[model samples]
Target: MVTDSQSGQGENNKTNENGSLPISRRGAMSRLVSLFLFIGFWTGIAYIASFYFLPFIQIKPGFIASALALVGILVAASVIFMVRVTPTGGSEARTLDFQTLIIVVFGTASLLAAGGITALSLKPPLLAGAILGILIIYVITLFRIIRFTFRSDREIEKIRSQYQDLIKIERAKTEFMTVTSHQLNTPLAEVRWGLESLLSAEGIEKENRDMISMILKGVNRIVETVADINKALSQKDKTATDYASELKTVQLAELILEIVNVLGGVAREKNVTLSFEGPEQEIFLGGNKDKLTSAIKNVIDNAIRYTPGGRVIISLRKEGASAIIRVQDTGIGILPEDTPLMFKKFFRGKNALLLQPDGSGLGLFTAREIIENAGGKIDFISTPERGTIFFITLPLKKTA
Candidate 1:
């Protein structure tokens, strides 16, 4: 909107960017009165201007009442111009435009006519009464403006209080997730390491070994998930400059395969066919392996949970500077009304709420955040009854 390089000078100099007078009712009444005393300066100038301009009229300050009457008429006309030119609405609506230009021109002319008429009127006492009546009317108008300001202030206070409470709640949620994730990490790692040692041991029986292997896989998945949560939560205080801070090389093909293996059980229970379509060779990139794994896992889990008894396809393809991952699902797709807020925190569609009443509803929200912080984007489209398709794009690392 600010397409031109410009600055204000001369009589219209501004103290702030938007050029509004700084007035508040909180200060002492005396200080407030003194701050707005520029009216005295204008009055003095008006009085002086009268002498040079009114002599030819032959109506001295102490000589006529008709001239005073004319001054009152002009003052009323100026007030009417102000009331009409003042546009409706809040601060933004009050900005000056063509209407403001008209007001400034007509109002200035009316005020000058009033001043000249007052000077020509020789009856100083009559001119004094005319000014008094105009001041009284303006005082009433100022009171109304003050009352509106008070009402606006109360509404602003309510919004501020609500905003502060929301901030506190969010901070608490982040702190709890970060702390709990860290606490769980230690024991989870120990369990994983212990299982790995046992599984690699010599002469283990086949049946017991199979059971241990399954447990180990589950434990390893949990550990990876916990690490991702801790890492994501820990970045709450970080900025865009912290992207890939704890990153390492990750193999996307193997990662998605592992996720498919883990969610395969859930897909079977739900009678949903889930599969992937991509190249056989691995797609390697620089990233935090655990975090990216968790993000993709969230998408797959959601797909399995929502599909009544259908198919979900996750496909990968490389094009230009990026690799695209698409997760297409045959599910109770998002309600049309809820599609816009899909990535909003804890926002579940009506169908989702009905399906999983206890669902935390932070899946896509967390997933999008992780992918974006790792310098990628996640987008999705959904229809009410048919299906949903999510698109994730990550920059492919350049070969040296």
Candidate 2:
């Protein structure tokens, strides 16, 4: 049984927002450039400092060059050590701290030792301080490189997590849809058989009329089940950007009328009047046409299912920034406890199940998912044995 918590826009929103990190290719390239540039600048500065300070030792020029070359090699080795010891892409603070410590220790020690030797004849405090300052700047550059690397790594991990979650949710939704579709097949076959039998009957008596009505009800159920499954599948694949497509701005009133016409015969059989009461004006909502139709069908079907000998009223109107669709039914209304779970997949009220034992209990859940995915909200006001009214509010699409 798929629960509402396990299959809806709420889950989708949470997964998209929290489970993924958004990193761009441009950002990655910039970080890589910054890292290499930092390393190059620091290595160059360290080499220059070694060349300048070696002459203070009062050695022969060739010997000073050889000694400075060796010192430069040591400083290069220290930089390599710092890079190696730095953590590979996590929190910047820890990597920065480790790199800073390495640079301070190795850099200060190298500068002081080199200065001590040079000071033997020249005793140039200014030269020593300058070397130390160069090393400090190198350390700072290294810190920037480490921070950028960590941030890049974190962003990559985030993208990976987002894809993983999207896959999981897609799989779960597919499984639920497949299972529900399979479940629907049996009832649909039964309804088809009943309808065929009614068509084959010879006499048109009151008793036969009752049987025909029952068959019609079964057919309605089959249709509703199919619509719910289709809606679920559509919602599973829909993204926010899809709303801007040409298919989303079509007329909604006509779609509702078509659905009502399909189910009208079944409603008549139950003596439950199903109808639409709204403006003739075109009400276009920003969503997939088939998906919105299925959503509305689910709500209307649910109304017809419970409202024995009563009426199911559907209305569509423009209100503020939203298109309001209301499905009100004079049925054996929901209990307070059941109201919360009414939209949960595979969940049915006690009275509802008693009335229709074969209900897959996925209609309301699927409807809610479809509505929410299309940037809408579905809510209800109900009391047991009184009636229920579901208000579906969706954003309106403006067109020239």
Candidate 3:
């Protein structure tokens, strides 16, 4: 009674026992075809050489025997080398198997072809020397090509594997956060009910009542925090799934101007001058209008919130093949140490926390994710006490 998982593991184990790597049906067929073609190349050259040049030189039985012996030695060495270097299993193994076969076939053919040509051209010492020299160079070139090809292929595979592992880890983290938030909401709701019931009861002394009120406030804050977490996670999941389908042509200039208008009042209250700089002509790009608006608004709002009295500038322009959106703020610039973790979730800089205690630190993280999902990237440069500049680039849509 073997389960499907157990059966799959058993199959993998069986493959490992045979070679360092397992080969797919298609890969095996492709390798066989390559081997035949490689052997045919050398065989064809040898046949042509024999037909055209064999009449010129006298043949000796001893020399022919020596050539045969050389080929046998090469074949044996190739077999041993292939066995020793075979990978434990996959595309690399398939590649190594094919390369080893090529090496053997090429070596054997070169030896036979060179020996025949040299033996026939022996009367012309120059021709024999030249033919041997060319064969030697060809062998060296083949060896160098195989060595570099395998090295690069292995390096690429390692990087690709690491990237995939990182993606899986990120997905797991997101799922855990969503589940934890849901669990916290249940307990948080119960706490809120208990607090409200206590507050509704008859007088329980002035000091005790004050303490309970503070405790209730704390519970309410926890509920809000949990709710925010759930919202962010759900939004991230939604954007990840619906990004491609939600895309439409959006005017870059108008979009930023709308965000600027909405946040202008907030900027004014803080004595921060907000301005929009863009060309009159509309710059169009393909993206989800709602997601793009959210992403752009987040960046602009952060700039306004962070700037104490200085101005926040929102600008858009077409730069070559990309639509560049720049948000520059003259604020308490980010600390050098905090710059690296600026866009990471739940990471508020020390300065940011000190200036604005209510900051959630999720805005930048969510903004970056949305921007990137829309085929754009955000980058920034900051100098403490001077200013910070954020650049968001999206590929421009081509028009007829």
Candidate 4:
């Protein structure tokens, strides 16, 4: 039932799927093997010229030995061609440039001319002329390579331009998603507030109360969907930020308290204890406050969502020059296989899907982007049925 285009797209998507170590390793091995083969070919040519040509030359032993040695040096120079040819990975545009081809030709000519002139015992003028011609060809080849290097510089500039455009597009997409989430939240919040007010009225029937509860749950689902989309959009923009100037001294404890307050109601509804446990001392770190806050909130929100009735703890402390933020929860932990993919967009573990089917799976991905952009790292430890703990460490200063 599938067309060729559809099938090809499926194959391309499969090729791009994450964590395929075997394929990458095979590619590296193939490159190494190719390099060895090229080296072997040059070595064989050098051996032939030294063994066969020296006996034919009528020149003195010293001249014959010098010619043979020069042949070996010429063979070694052929290896430099590898620098000009980049691996195309089977792409159509992959090819050797004219300069690369010229380098190979000139190197081969140099070795051949040296061997042929010595073997033929040609006139001194003819031998000198031939050697001079080979030298001139090599000089021209060198000039060509220099010109190609300039071309490559332009290509690099073009690539940078494309990267900037991609950044702009990502920023636009994130801004749109943020606006959309805000718009959706306004209506959902209004409806939920209206329903809660009506539920408080006296003499409301049990049936009506159950209907109101279902409506509230539906509203919450919509809010969560919007949140997921916004999180993904935020992630796109997070990668584009200039981290060096963005990070500044910010209060750690206050940020954690603000995030906990925002998610407090959600925790209360799930009968989970959400609390902060760390030094009350002022902990300051060089970081973008808004991005850091969002990242920490996402971690806390995740903990609250997975933990049914257990405790979720948010801790902050300074370890030397780095700030360490830990979020620990007594919840259904992640599987070993899924731990590495936890921060990847749209990835969900088995237990996570079982607990929350409506999750869009972008929370941790966004959190990772935020932390990484602020020159920090995020890691987690989890065991099934025990709990999960996420650790975020950020440098005290942005190092150049």
The local distance difference test score of each candidate is 0.65, 0.69, 0.69, 0.69
Q: How are the candidates ranked when ordered by TM-score, highest leading?
A: 4, 1, 2, 3
Tell me the lDDT of candidate 2: 0.69
Over 1-400, each residue of candidate 4 has an lDDT whose tens digit, in order, gives 2111110111122222232211220111233554564555445454534433344444665665666665665555444544533323333213434445656677667666666666566536565565556655654554444444445546656865676676679668767778878888888888989988888888999999999988888887888778777767745634435655676777788888888989999999999999997675777777788878888888899999999999998888777777888888999999999876787788888999999887888888888777777767788778899999888887775346
Question: Tens digits of per-residue lDDT for model 1 on 212-248?
Answer: 9999878865775675466456544544456567777
Looking at model 1, the pairs that clash are: 59-120, 60-121, 60-122, 61-121, 61-122, 61-123, 62-122, 62-123, 63-122, 63-123
RMSD (CA, Å), candidate 2 to true, equals 9.4
Q: Candidate 1: worst 10 consecutive residues by lDDT?
A: 1-10
Over 27-84, each residue of candidate 3 has an lDDT whose tens digit, in order, gives 1123444355335445543543353345544555665566556556555644554444
lDDT by residue (6-61, candidate 2, tens digit) is 22224433444544534333222345654665676566556545544445444555
- Candidates sorted by lDDT, best first: 2, 3, 4, 1
Model 3 TM-score is 0.51
RMSD (Cα, Å) of model 3: 13.0
TM-score of each: 0.58, 0.52, 0.51, 0.60
Q: Which segments of model 1 are wrong by more than 4 Å?
A: 1-34, 37-92, 95-101, 111-162, 169-238, 280-284, 398-400
Best model number under TM-score: 4
Q: How much is 223 displaced in model 3, in angstroms?
A: 8.3
Backbone clash pairs for candidate 3 read 20-87, 20-88, 20-89, 21-88, 21-89, 21-90, 22-90
